[model samples]
Target: MVKRSRRFVAFFLAALALVLALAFVAADRWSRITARDNAELAAQSVARANQGLLVSELQKFRLLPLVLAEFPDVAEVLADANPEATAHLNAQLELLAGRTDAAVIYLIGRDGVTRAASNWRLRTSFVGQNYGFRPYFRGAMRDGASELFALGTVSGRPGLYLARRIDQNGRALGTIVVKVEFDRLEKAWGVDGGIGLVTDPHGVVLVTSRPAWRFKTTEPLSRRALEDAVRTLQFGPSPPARAPLSLSGSEASVGAGRRQEPYVAGTLPAPIDDGRLTALVPLQPFLEDARRVALLWGLAILLVAGAIVAVLLRQWDRQRMLLQSRAALSLEVERQTAELRDTNARLLVESQEREEATNKYVAAREDLARANRLGTLGQITAGVAHEINQPVAAIRTFAENSTKLITRSRPEDAQLNLGRIIALTERIASITSELRSFTRRKTPVPVQATLGSIVDGALLLLGAKASSQIEIAVSRADREHVLVGDRVRLEQVLINLLRNALDAVGKRPGAIQLTASAQGDRMTIRIVDRGPGIDPAIRERLFTPFETAKSGGLGLGLAIARDIAREFDGDLWLDPMEGPGAAFIVSLRIAR
Candidate 1:
């Protein structure tokens, strides 16, 4: 009997050891796989974040030229030919350059002499410099339009240049050049541990995230590692099949092992006048996290095994105790059963509370939906009022004219009055058609529409209040000539902005300027008012539902406006204007 028991124990120990060994091997393999997957995911997330930052910085860089092109002063200078305008233009350029991130804004005359420059320190140096031979200036003059250039440092700063030739009739007058600082481009990358570089097919790093390393002619071993990693990494759709691996060496080792790791990378072709953009990232952190998870799983398996062993030992001991006192065991079992019943009752009440909470959430969502519907209805009403008021006002004017003709007893004058009345009635019919289209419930239909029409409709709705005292200016220079959006929704947005501007002006004699323009694939609309702007105290809460500055205002106008904009993939924001006014800017993406 003793020998049999010992044999049994020996067999059990051997089986346990075999199970542990297998577990350890399987766990290690799984840990490595999980780590690799996690690392790849992390690298992909980083790459996407980096890409967004790059695009944002590029947009910022583009702003320098765009802003200059839209400046009223620049427009005025282009329209007029006064010789003294040079001094005024120089001063304006200098002011704009100081306020912006541009390194310089220089004007080159048709004769190739640098006429006026924003950079005063370089004014004398560039005055006689003949840049007519420069590609940027020459190309613009020849094309009669704007041109972009990417070349070595023109003013000791490696950057992009935007040049537009000033033209009157068919003759070129001068070229306006705006220089963007490349150092700012490095700042945009914001990659701390590793460096990012824009490379050509020849393996030349054209631009780098590190300012100190940008345009440097040094060929380091790390550069070779990066090149090799780029070549090895699949960067294709099947991320799992082509894991990224990092090269291990030197200071560049930070991104070295990235080649074997999984990552997301996309090669973007160059813009019309720029080079390609390639992004790289590492997956070390994600891999580490996966390894940690595997370790935790291994620990849990070991813990469960230990618990099974304890339960088996307890059961064996219980068998011995039951033999000694069966009656005592029965009493203990009953006590356990009673305790379980009490615990179950408590769980039931807790579940009930959770159900109630869920119901409340559903109710809240229903309320929000109702509120949105009502807000849409309000916008439609406002637009209808604006659209119809114009024709009604015209009819009023025509009626008064007819009455005067009748009083004068002039038959010919009366005939002209009748013609005007007929024209006014036709205009009224057009207004009704517009109102029907705007007010009717319909599905979202995107189409190309002019922003000027929307602005006109919005202003007409508020015309009764604006009248003669308040000046309204509409500028479509910045707006996209053709936009793809829901006409009714856009009209609603315009109406909200106009109403807000009218409210701001109140009884005060102020000017409201509405301007629109297209930048890249986006349309921007700015509504500026020279009335008592919003108070700083309530500025942050301006768009919050039920938050209002006016006594009778519902405070939902701006909130609803924001919702409509977002539904169409747009944004609305408020900021203090450059002058003494408030500026509200709405941005929407242009449909491709």
Candidate 2:
């Protein structure tokens, strides 16, 4: 049972393992897909937020230069090249710069000279300094307003220059420029986490959260882009994006400062300044989450599979126990059968001795009683002797046939006849053994047997004694049905029921019906006699051992038969009814 159950479990586990593995594989694939998409979204969200904040910051100072250009004093310094007018404008410019949070505020003349400056109070002042090389300066002379990001020549601070043309009646006079710095904005992005960068049209990192990452290019710059950098001096004295790192796809490991870290990066176009925003997210946390889910699912599958296998093994053990019990029953039945044969042999010898010791005839009154009591016993004994006679007679005829074949000098024909004679002797022995076993005290041990076979064996043992009165008929379906009981014991039970039925009819031409049937898991054999039914007085103690209605009966036959039936997981009873004769029914378990 264990071995067979293990094989079943192994196959079960193998099938379950395959299904679970497929499920895990599907989950893993889904997790990877979801993680990748979520990473991109996370990076995009971070980029959009930082970019919006940076643009709003820069926009706050956009109108400053244009508004300052229309101021009267800012034009006074340029209209008259007077030192007193410049000094007055410089004082106003300094106050305005502090109010507007400008890094440096200055007015540049049409000659590309800084006529007035806010930082004139410091030693690195822009008064009387030439700014013709600056794009904002040249652009403002023709265009009304222009913003350019670059490093200041004097302050050396990197900032955006918002320059506006100073005009009177459509005639350009000088330009007003406001320089804006983003030290605060960059500092804020750093604290919020994730690397932030705003690149120019040339792809140069202009504003960044990291100091080391500033002015670095995400992709390679061409010679023209390099020239634009030189003219604008957007990176000041710093190198243009540190030889543009060799970029892979959105996800890759690259050096940030000194050490390389794995990252999943994404780009979003900035709506404010036409720059690109990029963010990188790590993959370690996502991987850990998928691993945890897989572990949990795997554990659950094992638990369920283990439970099913345990139940299957338990059922297997029960079946194994039933098989072992059946084997033991067969052995026990054989042992009892052998013992019955021995006991019957001893009893027969003792009976013969007692008969001889007693007188051949009792006195007149005792003779009538003895004849009445011993009649049934005499009939039963005659039946057994009659059963043995047929086989003995066949043996005698075959022996005569053998002798005649030998007289004809036909050795082969003689040998064939001799074999039949031997077979007949064995049949006689078998009949006697069966008769002895039938009369013995039965100790039933249940085993699987066909009801029909037991019924046929019982009728055969009765010989011609009950053949004329008894009509035995079993349904074809019932004949094939199995009963769980010792074969010999069941045969004995049927024989007892039949004999009682035959005796009930006696010499009368009455019908005794024997029929086999099945209901659910039970097999039944019914014997009905059409003779005077059992008397009410006798019926009360019908199955009591050693109490009999028949004068010669010890009454142990019906009691022993009932007991044997019960031992074989069956029952024998006289079913009550308003009928002509008694109906005895035997019921037993069907083999599974």
Candidate 3:
């Protein structure tokens, strides 16, 4: 047994350990997944914000070229090659560039020669430079308007160029260009710790918070693609390099060599250009938090398992002790059994006598309960007789009137009188039917009965006694509650309580209120009267047999009512209140 117990404990511990390990693994995986999703959402929000900022900046510079193209000086400069007009337009361009926050504004003739520039005073300027091969200038000349992001050949800085064709008499004269740089935007974007990149339609990093990432391909470029990029000079004379980041779906490995770190990456389209905005959020903090969460879960599971194991071990020890005591108990029981053999025979005889006495006691109790119910019926028999007499007299009068009407040759009136007689007869029958059902004696069989029906039946029985001063209100919901009790017996309980309340408030100005409500799995019926409260002397023994405050009263009504209540697993008692008047409450279980 000792070895078996040891083995059982060992197996339990092993199982518990395996469960703990599995819990840890599952918890870690779930936490990591949740963390990843949250990080992705944060990255997506950042990318959208960046895209909005980029689009707003580009839009501010977009109108500069269109407005400049409409200038008459611009058409004259391109058509006449006028140096004076060019010089004056250069200063105007300078002022417009400053007001619009544009990087530079320059004009290019149809031949692609720069006629004027906003930065003409600066050494690295576009004045007199030919841009015939530039995509923006060529596109503007062909389509009347165009936009391109490229590295400046003069300043070696990357910017977006918005261009529109200058027209003279509907003839294209030159192309007006506006440049927008993002140095300040990148600086602001980098203040918050995360990587940000703006990728062109071909997946080239046109702008980024990280300078080294600019003009780099987001993914590896093919040989032909690299050659095309270098030939077009979209980025620079040198071929665009691949970004250091390696992306796979939403995950990214940023940086290079030993410095590389994992990130949750998100990409979204930019509103202004055929471009994509990318934001990368670091995973270290989220991963650490996930680990902490997983660790907490593991600890919680371990504590619960340990507690269970301890309980099992304790029970095992108790079982072992019980086994040791069981043998001694067996021997003692055998000795006692032999000693009590004759005593048992005597006990059997005594038990039979006791059982007989108990049976008699139960019979007596039931007989007293039946007698009480009959006595209650007798008390109401006078009212019942009065009610029956009124209906009987009405029926006789209606019959006499019908006979007279028929004798007078008024057959329709006679038929109406006969119908009234039938209604009176029904009223008589209903009164008698209720009395018979109430006085009938049978074994109590509890069943699911609606409270509404019980209340209705009880009220019907007490209709003779219930006055307008006695207000009875049962809520629809409360009436719907089902009680587990004999319908007849339960009705008796309500009748007794309500009758007592009516007696208490007899000829009184105050009202007697009876209400029923359901609470949890129990139903409660309260009968409250505003008459003089119960005599304090009998308060304690209110439910005792033969206890009464009225003269010539049996006082068995409350006692029997309480007994019936208990028979069906219910209870009845007088509830104590501060002011005049008495309250009785009956509580019973609600059937599931």
Candidate 4:
């Protein structure tokens, strides 16, 4: 029966470990999925922001030709259609080219002759070219403004051409064409680790961030991805109920429309002045980050599992050794019982020792319970202190200002101070409300707040009782540094530690320095005191509940402060610096 019980216990422990291992794996997978989804959402947001910038840029291009056509000299030259007038027009065109990113600005006469041009000295090839039949010029004559069209070449550059017909007394005279470099447009679209494409409604690529990829056959993977996205988009704006279909034989998770997930593709309707822009961001890069997290989680779980197995095996071996000792002791006990039958008096002393051992065990259990209770109280006190500090500080500041005004005999200043004092009193009342709620053991709500404010609040709560001889200095290295945390809880930790430091210093000219600074992904706050430093004998037991160095004092302050730090996924530890002062450090993870 004993062997069977041991076997059952061993199997049970193994089964428990296996269950825990599986849970760890599931948790890691869920985390990866969540991370991937968030990355995709970020990518989509970036794409939308880029689209807005591109549309604004396109509108600027559309306006450039209209702006240039209004120049009086150009208008006058086009109306006269004379050689000397054309020379004045040419000079204005040169100024336009030098001032803007426009490649060339020129006038195309009704008779299909390039009468005047800018950079014509550089490119005489375009001189007198018959461009009267060009769609951009014809469109400007027909429509009020020129429609954007792909210009094949004046210099072998495919660009958007904007033209405006020169009219005098309601008679069409000629056309003014402005060629905007498409290469610049392409550069603007290419951002955020992805390519953007502007295509006409007919699917012909008008411009692309990647010119080399233009008109190239889509890869099988990309072709299927594009087709699936188009189909998903066809279904309209509703999000897919489940994961959209992935590209065939690929691990990539594809979605049809814009999504908050790790991968997104969508056709954004460009402004009416420009063609539609299709934005596609590959999720594979973002998934790599998720995969890395998963790998780390797996490694951590494996380490924990291995440790559990080692502990269980050691326990089993120890139990076996204990059982062997018990068997040998039983045999010896039988022999002793026979001998004790002849000397029963000696057995009483042995029984007394057994009773003493049992008493020791009971005392140990009582001590453990006392420690637990003290730890719980310490946490409660720290939280209370943190919550009460904010308003107390505000009230103190206002009261001090009011006192100064009244003493100065300035009636107007005193009146203004009285209003501020009232405002501060109301603030104190609100803080009291929060304190009442916090002490009721409510869950903490995290918010973005400055470290400076938290420190001030803590100092305020301590008030004058914090020891007049103790000079407390709170300094922030960078004022703009912000952290996301439960403000009340953080203040509680700070105030408790500060109060302890003040007590440590006692009625002497001791300095307590509270310093806060940020170091990438973490914020470190150091509380240093120049009091009688921690006694070497009790330094290790400083955080142990109910173990105080000071007479008649409960040693729960440091314990409670540590608990609050851990609650925020941070840590509090004693600094190992050797000096005449004691320092305690609290480190918290900063929000990225």
In candidate 4, residue 460 scores what lDDT? Answer: 46
Candidate 4: C-alpha RMSD to true structure equals: 25.5
Q: Compare the candidates by TM-score and give the number of the best one.
A: 3
Kindly report which residue stretches of model 3 are placed more than 4 angstroms away from their true locations once superposed: 1-7, 222-224, 257-259, 271-273, 316-592
**Each candidate structure's count of clashing pairs:** 21, 2, 0, 5
Candidate 4 Cα outliers beyond 4 Å, as residue runs = 1-36, 188-192, 215-267, 272-274, 321-592
Model 4 misses residue 443 by how many Å?
55
lDDT of 1 by residue, 482-503 (tens): 5567766677777777677766
TM-score of 1: 0.40
Whole-model Cα lDDT per candidate?
0.62, 0.75, 0.84, 0.65
Our tally of clashes for model 3 stands at: 0
Q: What is the TM-score of each candidate against the true structure?
A: 0.40, 0.49, 0.52, 0.44
Residue 13's C-alpha lDDT in candidate 4? Answer: 75
**Residue-wise lDDT of candidate 2 within 1-592, one digit each (tens)?**
5787789878987888898889888878866766666666776777777777877877778878767877888777778888888888889889988987888899998898999999998999998899987888888787777777777878887777889999887778889998888898788776745666677776677777777766777777899878877776766755576522334567745565666655566677764346666665655555567667766877887788789878776778878887999999899999999999999999999999878656443243234323322433355677768767877888888888888989999999989988888887887787777665554544445655787777767766777666767887888788888789777767767767777888788866447888877888888778888878988988889887678878867676677678767866788898997857889888888887
**Model 2 stretches astray by more than 4 angstroms:** 15-28, 243-253, 256-259, 271-273, 293-592
Query: What C-alpha lDDT, on a 0 to 100 scale, does residue 206 get in candidate 4?
Result: 52
lDDT per residue for candidate 4 within 481-559, as digits (tens), equals 5666777667777767776787777646547777777788788888888877888998888888777887766776677
